[model samples]
Structure formats: C-alpha cells, structure tokens
Target: MDINLEMINLIKGEFDIHVLIELPQTMLHANIFDLNANLNEYDSLTSFWPVAGKWQLEYLEEYFSGCESVHFVIYKPGSKLDLIKTTYKVLKFINKHKFDYLQFDDFSARQAFLLPFLKLNKRLILSIHDPIPHGGEFEWKRSVIKKMFYGKAKAFITYSSFSKDLLRKTLGLDKQVVNLNLLPYTVFRKFLTHHTVEQERGYISFVGRLSQYKGIDLFIEALPTILKEFPDQKFMIAGRPAFGYAVDSSKLANMASSVSVMERHLSNQEIVDVISKSKLIVCPYLEATQSGVVMTAYALGCPVLVTNTGGLAESVLDNYTGMVAKAISSDAIAAKILDFLKLNLYQDMHAHITGDQLVSKLSSSNLETLSQIYI
Candidate 1:
C-alpha cells in the first residue's frame, strides 16, 4: 500500500463531515456516482469510493471541484486475510478525526469486523438494497454480517417501499427506516446517443449481468413463440454471465438470423449504443429488489417490460414509462411483449421519459427533503 502522508493530512482536515462509504462494483457505487454528479460543491458530504469506479469518476472529477473523496483500493470479496489487513490499514488511516456520521452506502463483511473497534461518537446509517440473498449468494454469511450492521445502525434507508416493508415486517427492524428512490446512473449519459424513440434502430434487447435469478431462460422460452409471430424482429442479449446461468442457449441456437447473443460484459459505449437505440428491453427476473438496469433504460429514454416481482415494477409506470408482465411465466412474458408491440406502446414512451421532466420526477434526490434525514 502506498502512503501519502501529506495527502492524508489534507483530507483529514476535511473530515468531521458526513462520510458515505460505498461498496465497489455494485449499484451503491452507481448511486453515489449519480448523486455526486448533481452536487454543486463539496458541502457536508465526503465519500469513499473504490478504485473500480475510476473509469467513470475520473471524467466527473474535473468539475467535481474538490468535493473531496478517498478512492480506496479493495480486493474483490472472498479473502479473509486481505479483509483483516485492509481493515487495520483503514483503522490507522482515518481513525483520528471523528466524522459527523458514516452513511454506509452498502454493507460488507469487512465493515462488520471493523465496526467494534470504532469507539467514535459518529452516527451510523445503512442503506438496504436487497433484504435477502439472491439465487447463489452465501445466505448464512451475508445474513450474519447484515444482522450485525442492522443492530449497530441508527437509521436505515431503502430504495423502495417494498424493501423497507420487508425489513420492518419480515426482519422486524426496530430502527428508523427511510425509503428513497435510487437516482439514475447519470454516469452513462456521457455515452448517450441522439436516437429518438421514433428514430430508434436497435432491436428487442436484454442488457444486464446474467444470472439464474435474472430468469433469462423464461424469456428465451417465450422467444420462439415471439419469433413465429414476427420472424423479422431481431433480439439481442448483451450481458456477461455470472453465478451460473439457469438457461440453455441451445434453444435459440438455430435462430441466428433473429437473435444475437453476446455472453460477455458490455463497455459503457456498447451499453449506450445498445440501450439508446433499443425498441424496448425486457427484464425477466424471477425475483428482484429495484433495478439499476430499469433506471438506466429510462435514463436513455428506452421502454422496458418487467415481471411483477419485488421492486422492479416500481421502477416504471405501467403502460406509461413502461409495462409489466402479468406473471413470471413464459406465457405471460410473451403475451405482454405481444401487447407492447401490437399496441405500439414501445414507440409512444419517449415523450414521457426523456429530458428533465423524467429526471426530475424519478431521479431528483430532493437534497432539501433529504437534508433533514442525513443530518
């Protein structure tokens, strides 16, 4: 680890402000990235971001105008020795000045181990994105870590009412829980296209990190039926696979002319090109708790269809910004996709979702409204 004693002294002087520590490579990073983009100056908030987000944050940092940040280097989760070493290094680094509060943008095992050593009077706040583990996550371990954080946190934030309700009703949360909508990932705006809804040229697409919980199989199951009805329609699957996929691509193997599959992760420009020009994107998740992908599609003025699971439907207004499938089954997904096409709803959503109108309604943080809570 490189130590910059002079840099530490400078940032240390800037402490005693609210510090939002965000986990890397997750929606939490995207959330802070979006909020930071809208900030006019370095006010009460000082944040810690991972080096992984440097690709986008570096571009934003120029106008960020000394809104101070500590970009910590982190090892990908799964190493206990590294977590222990990193925790101690962090303890020695910033334990000198007590902060106004530490808003944990997300929780992690490393934080669980470090919490007891912090004898400071700083208030602790946590944001809960998913109440439970997804398909292949280590439920026992993550649940233990979350339980520890839940007990220590003074307040909690949830991106959707559904998640808040679950924490209160299911987990029996005794802490004050505030619900807030996650801001759109404005970091992607740098690559946004000028494609209008009427001028869109991309085909039906699925864009996200693929996993079993995402239910990509359900959509693929319904595709043949869809292809039969509209053989000329092209479909693109653009995401890298993770945690073992539930679907078999062989079913779509013969439909090369109609379907295009890219089983790797997409770069920012690639994401923009695919989503900005898309006719509509479908999210066939078996379960979900809000979605950055839904918000990203809206940011790009693309229509979306989501299954009625968790907080996914909360991301869009049914039939207005986007539509929702009646059920999680293939038949339901196919029927809704058919409805969207036959009614021409896909071509009608741009005016409702583009520009500041949609951003103000959906993405605005209402800093004033939130000021009372953060403090």
Candidate 2:
C-alpha cells in the first residue's frame, strides 16, 4: 500500500502543489473505465475485490496525508454501484481531511451521483472531456452546462476549442469554460535520445485500438498498394483491440505478411519505443472525438498521417507536422502516405520540436492551469 515517494516528489516539484487525490485501485485499470481491458484474460470484472480495495485505500490515504490540496479525478460512468460506493468512501475521507479541491471528469454523471456531497462543497470542479460533439450542435456542451448549473461547482474544464466554442456560442458560458489540451510527455523523451537523425525507417505505424472506427481495416485494405511500391517496407500495428470490435489476427496476417500486428496491450514505454523508431504514425480513424495518439506522435517527433475527421484534424496541422487523409478510405490513406514519403521535411520538423522544447511547453505550467480550475 506504500505510495511512490519519487513520483509524488516529482509531481510536487514540477507543479509546486502539495497534495493530489489518487483514486482507489479500482479505477486505475478497472474494466469499466477502460474498454480495451475487457478481452484480456487478466482483467478482473468483480467489484470490491478485497485485496485491491484494501491496498488502494491504504495507499491513497497515505498519499493524501502528504499533500496540501487533494484533487480527485473521477472518470467512471454512473451505472456501477461499487464505483459509486468507493467514490463516496473517498469523498468522505477527503471531507474529513478538508481537501482543497474535488474534481470530477464526467460533469453530468458526477453531478448526478455526487450531488449531495458536492452541493455542500463550493470548491468542487465539475469537468468534461468530450472531444467530439455528441449529437448535432454539440449536445455534450449543453448537457455539461446543465450539469454545472445543477451541481453548482466552482468552475468547469474541457479539452478542445470545438467544445469551448459550443459552450460560448450555444450555451453563452465562455468565461466558465477552460481548455487544456493533452500533453505528450512520453513521446517527447524518445526524441531526445537520438544524437544523429537517421534516414526515415519507411514504415506505416498505427498505435491504438483495433476497433472498426480506428480505421485498422482501412490500413489493412490499403496494404496491397503500399507494399507494391515499397516491398520491404513494414507496417507495425500496436495496442489491444476494443471491446465488441474484434479481429482475426491469423487471417489478417495471412492476407498481408507485410503487416506486422502486435495484437496485445503495450506498456507506455513500449509505445514510446515503437513510435520513436517509426517513420510515421498513421491514425486512420474514421471518426475520432479527441486523439491522445496524435499528441503522443508529435511529442516523440514522429510525424503523424491522420484522417481529416474529428479532433485528428485539430491535433495534426495538415502538411505541417503530418498529412491528413480522407476519412474511411484506404486509397486516401495510401495516397497520403505516398505523399508523405515523397517529402523530405521529416528532419526539419523533428528539429523544430525537440524533446526538451515539448517538455517545457507541456510542463508543470499546464498542470498549474489545471490546478487553478480545481482550486
């Protein structure tokens, strides 16, 4: 149950913050929180597993004791009773400690479930991370503002300008909303290790879920044309497949030998390694809300070739950091890849955003802004 002192110190040193709330172990790798873990054999679906809960509670209590202000970041949906109970237990403990801020990631669900406790605390920050508009006219923004109105929190935070615009234009709540984009810390470090820039590795790498919307099938379909031009070029596919959208890897491999698929969950370190070694990271998503992968790729100085859909466009400046292909089309993806290969600007772009530069840009200052919202 012991907390990592080094990690705590690192966070404190970077942000000049005393305490941060850590959720119980349940939410860390919980099946409900992450759909990618559903198919894994090691995933435990049962709620309130005695050992994990006990250890997590003990660890979190110790961690909270050391910090000045503990901000709890909750990301679970409202359906699970066990999650609710666990959250309540944490909240009660935080109440006793008189923590500085209580932050909830899902505005509506958190407001609904934690309304009783949150109503008493005027320091609560109800936040949302809706990357794409839910229905038409950014229904998610309206829903969030409604939640904020009901919850009566100190402030609200969101991730993108699209959502921020919807909040301002549709809801007329611009002053109440804050936009803090995702930081690519992992990718930034990889770029620093290489002393001399080598020739482009010349492979298309896709690092995310293998679901239908992820455009894995599109990448598979385009393999024939891609391989025809560069027979020796390889295609690396990392990350576990999403729930309910499974793929037959054996059949997929037989169809395209050039396509090297790592059909397993990769650790954060492994992800950085794969991205750093690649020529380009292909995010061929048919539809995306917000992209963590795009930011990760840019952080690693690995140019991205993404589709012109959703937040992918927002993340990758087309023909700048990377190219944007037509959505849901393999031919378009292949064309973009071909176009990218033809260009000789990889090193120039890589030099522009060094690891230290990215780290400084996405450093403690960003987290400080987030802290302001919570405080």
Candidate 3:
C-alpha cells in the first residue's frame, strides 16, 4: 500500500506514478498460478490493469479509490504466441506514455523475453521478490536463468535483506540493490480492525494456497502424533489447493473428528476472519522466499509456527514473534507445534508481534523506504 500512503501524504501530485499490469487473462480465469486465483478482488495500493473485461475495469476503478490512473493490457497465457501478444501491447503503451522508468515486480522468463523488445526510453528496474527461487536447483542453471532476467535491469529491489544477499550471491552482481524488511498488506488493516472472528482459542490453523512444497501433507502426517497428546485440539486447513494439486480426501477421512478442511478460494474477509480466530497459524513450507501469511498473522495479532527455511524464518523472531521449526521434517514441525501450544508462548508472541514499535517499523518506515526507492 505504498502508493496509497503516498497519495494520502499528497506525494502522488509531486511525481507521476502509474500502475501497469500485464495480466495473463487466460491464466487469471483458469486459476493456473498460485496468486492469480484470488484476483476477483484487488487489495494492493496500485490500481489493476483490467485486461479481463470492462466489468473488471469498472471494479478496479472503484477498488483503487484514491489512485488516478488505471490501465489494462491483456494477453493470452504464457506461451510463445502469448509473449508476442503481450509484448506488442506493452510496446504500444510504452511508446505512447514514454515513462522515464519501468519497474517490474515479476522477474519471470516471460518478462525476461519481453524485456529486450520493449522499445522505450525508460530505465528498467527488476524487483526481485525471490532473488533465488525456492527449492534446490542446479547451480549453473539457476545462475544462468537469474542472470538472463536480472542482468537486463538497471537496478533491483528486494523485499528482505536475506533475499538481497541471496540475489547478490546468485547473480554475482554489484548493481544497486534496495532492501525493505516487510511488505505490509495494509488494506486488510481497515477491515481486520473492525471485525474479529471471536473464535474459541483452541484450533491450530494452516491457511494459504495448498501445495506439496507448502507442506500441507507434512502437516497432515504430523496430525496423528499431535492428536495423541492434545486429542481435543482441532486442526483447520483453509484455502484452495495450488492450481492443479488435488486434495486427497482419503487422508482426512480416517482422521480424528477434530480435523476440519475447507478446500476452496477464501475471500479476503474470510481469510482475515480465519486468521483472527486462530490460536496459532502454521506454515510448514519446505522452502519460501518471504511470507505474506506470516505478516497477516502478525497483523491479526495471532502467532505463527514457520519452518526455518529461506525468508520464512526471517519473518518471525523465533521464540518471540513466533516459533520456528528446526527442520522441514514432519517430526520437527509436530514438535514445534506442541511446544508452542503446551508451553504457553502465545501471550508473549502476541505482545511482540502486535507491539507498537515493530508494527510502525514494518508499516510506516518500511513502506516509506519502498516509495522513496521508486523515485
């Protein structure tokens, strides 16, 4: 919500800031990607490029209430033909507007291909959320692919210092890098502040898109052991599965009655409600860059249990803001959960996570740093 705060501070009138979205309409509708499935609503500061249809355009117009400009450029999926279509549209827009700088939050192969063809008088900045993609890959191939996309940019932006170090090491770059600790999903603050689920403090919830790497199956495998001791403790799994992954109902069938699963897209409000009601949020990812889920949990004044992988553990302060699993193993994850629940670390974690000092640093100073980087 950097742009929103910028507007609130009367900074938008000082500099021309525009939002461009090269939306893959086909995939957006098909829900092929992790984040695209829930695009029915826009929660960010910048307005959406309504490439889907006029109705979406209208919705975005209303959604981006304080922003002035909202433009749309549509293309097919991420095939070769789709690249050509998207490049053509992007080129036309760049030529017409003639912006001084173009910043891309997506440093994918598709964007890398389209970068060379963008005939514009603009300095390109590649905002690398995950400097190195999560999971192990051949070092040479990883380096090659990263340099292919990132090498084309004039500068780079990383959301966390951990990502910046990883990017520098991966790309072997000496270029200018801007780092911000956490990116707040501040729009939820308004709604989340007004409403809380008022749930009874018992269920341990795992929320977010389900996938193999996300460790939902690991969570499940750990369930039997957890239920052995705290049989009354409920485990709730919320949110839709990752694009093509299946929810093996068989896994849940023979489990204790304390397990509850809701396998569908949850609305923004629904997510806030679930998190608000949760006694603890579990993110047992095998790998990750940064977690918006952890930030959300903090915003809702709920503690988290995250595996010590990538930037996931960086988002948490271990025994303070939340507990971290020592390893990705199910045994490790189960043990950590039991420790948090049984040891009664919630009050301290809640205090630390929702404290005024940390909250201001994450939301105010962190966001201001981001806005300054754009200029």
Candidate 4:
C-alpha cells in the first residue's frame, strides 16, 4: 500500500522500471499487496521466495503472469543456510545485469550484503527518507557501516528538505540531494469517491501502522483530555501493528469509551474510507522523515494535526495545510488537538490542498528532478 501510485504514474512513461520483491511463491496469502494488480505499468517483476520447491514453482508459473520476465530466486526465511543461498543467488543476478541506475529506498540488515556490490557507486542513487536513527549509538553505528560500506552514491532523493538535511548533517552525505516535494498519493481517489458517505464524516483519526516511534501510544494517551472538550467526539485508531510491534487491543478498553479501534491492516479502499470519515487525521510521531499518511490525508482533502518532529512539521504549512503540535508530549498533543478543533481550521485547509493543486505542484518540477537522475 506504500506504493506511490502518483510516482508510478509519473515514471512509467519514461522509465522501464523493474520491481524486485520478496514474496511467497503463491500470492494467495499475501495481505500487504496484490502482485498481479496494477502491475501492467511495470517493465518486469521478479520475486524471491522461500523454498520454491517443485510444486510451488509450478503454482507460481500458473498463478502469476503479465510480467515480461516472471522469475523466482529461492530463499528460506529465518534460516542461515537459505539466507546464504539467497544472497549468492541475488548477487549472481545483480552481477549479470548492467542497469542505468539503482535507487535504494531502504538500507537495512537484509540489504547489507548487497552494499559491497556498489563498485560503481556513481550509478547508485540512495533514497534515505529517514536518515537519522530512532535510537542512539546502535543505529548510528549501523548507518556509518552502511555509508562506509556503500561509499558515495551518485545522487540522493528524499520527500522533504528536512530528511535531506538530516542526511547531510548526520550521514555527511554531500551528494546532489533532491526533494520531490509533496507528491500526491491518489491511489484511492476513486475509492474515496465511491465508498465515502457524507453522513459518516466527523471523527478524529490516527491512520497508519501502530508503531512506538509513530507515537500512536501518545495519541491514545492523549485521548482522555481530548474527549473532555468534545464529549460526543469519537477517536478512531485505524491501522495494524508495524513489523515487530503489537498494538494491545486490551488497552483500548481502559481508554475513553468512545475510542474506536480498527486493529487490522486496511485495504486501499478501507484506508480512504477511514480517512474520509474523519474531520482531521492526527500523526503524533516522536520522530519521522516524511509521512505517507499525511500525504494520503492531503490527497483526500482531509486536514491533518501532526507532531512537529522531523519532516512531519515540514509537510504541513501550519494553519494553512495542517497544524503541528507544540511539542511531542501527551499534554502538548492534547492541547493542539483541542486548539485545532477550537479554531475550525479544516474548511480552510481542505480548500487549499486540492487534487488539482497537488497535481500542478507535483508536475514538471518533480518529473524534471527525478528525470535528471536517469540522465
């Protein structure tokens, strides 16, 4: 669901982009994405699966198609023997092809092995959305290892200047960094128009995966104070847990009686419906680079109340596009929510962040900047 449909639309015409994904052989159980849907725009699609044994391979051959080259490389999940095999297979594949450029959206332990293949660093473009680590030294050490291991890339791209600056200051990256400012994610535009009922409008929402760094806990903690002001107001927490984090549904019981919890991963249509039903989307992140949730809110013309950390504040124009918290504390978040409601800022913001406005802003400028990387 994080696939930027807007970015896909922008680059599909000019770029022959291939998608490399790690998935099970049969996508029947895949919840995060549908490999077959909306893939006609891609040049090729390759999946790395765990034990693509004889039967699984046959199932993949039959179930998956439309990709120019439907290929699979086997890698057993959570097993050292298979990880080594997968690494070697992936390295061999990389060695065989010569790409014009490579853009890394993330750099983690899973990708650490591929860093050494960066002999031609100039053809590599590092896209660091969250440049600084959430924790202290451990993350910093990992980042340094990544930078030194990969060496310097030809260029860097980020969603906001705040993240780009963080990359420069924290990682000492001096490459040509470009900010593809505020690209609209209209993946659910049609869905919103169809499924969103006008009568369902008006609840304060926290949309996206519930992670500690995302500060959904802070938003939950702030709910008591928020409800004191608007007794009839309902607060909806709509999203599943992020990777290793579990959102304890039991805690919702102890909280205010009006808090609605949608603790499952929502589809694109469901996400649009939740966002559309809300008067304001709140992101109480303790740290962030850029928020796709905020962008999604903007795309739907829904105003946001975000914490003033990292690029969250930068994403909003403060009182114009959205409101930012005074601080990251529970008290600060509650105060901002109440204050935002008092001012009645949604109508003004909704008028400003229109689909046409985002399209105009996302057009030639972003396209030119991204096209330059290919050049």
What's the lDDT for all of these models?
A: 0.67, 0.58, 0.67, 0.68
Cα error, candidate 4, residue 338 (Å): 2.8
Better of 2 and 4 by lDDT: 4
Q: Which stretches of candidate 1 lie over 4 Å from their true place?
A: 1-57, 62-66, 73-86, 92-94, 120-122, 170-173, 193-200, 362-369
Worst 10 residues of 3 by lDDT: 30-39
Question: How would you encode candidate 3's per-residue C-alpha lDDT over 174-277 as one tens digit per residue?
Answer: 56677766634444554564447455556789998876668788888888888888888888899877646656778778784988888888766677778877
Cα miss at 82, model 4 (Å)? 7.3
Question: Tens-digit lDDT track for model 4 on 88-207?
Answer: 766666666766776666655655766666456488877666676553213555766667533657787788878887777654445677888766565546565644846466889999
Q: Judged by lDDT, which candidate is best?
A: 4
Candidate closer to the true structure by TM-score (higher is better), 1 or 4: 1
* Residue pairs whose backbone atoms clash in candidate 2: 19-67, 19-68
Candidate 2 TM-score, true structure as reference: 0.66
What TM-score fits each model? Answer: 0.78, 0.66, 0.75, 0.75
The predictions' CA RMSDs to the true structure, in order, are: 7.7, 7.6, 5.7, 6.3
State the lDDT at 325 in candidate 4: 85
> Cα deviation of 32 in candidate 4 (Å)?
5.3
Worst 10 residues of 2 by lDDT: 31-40
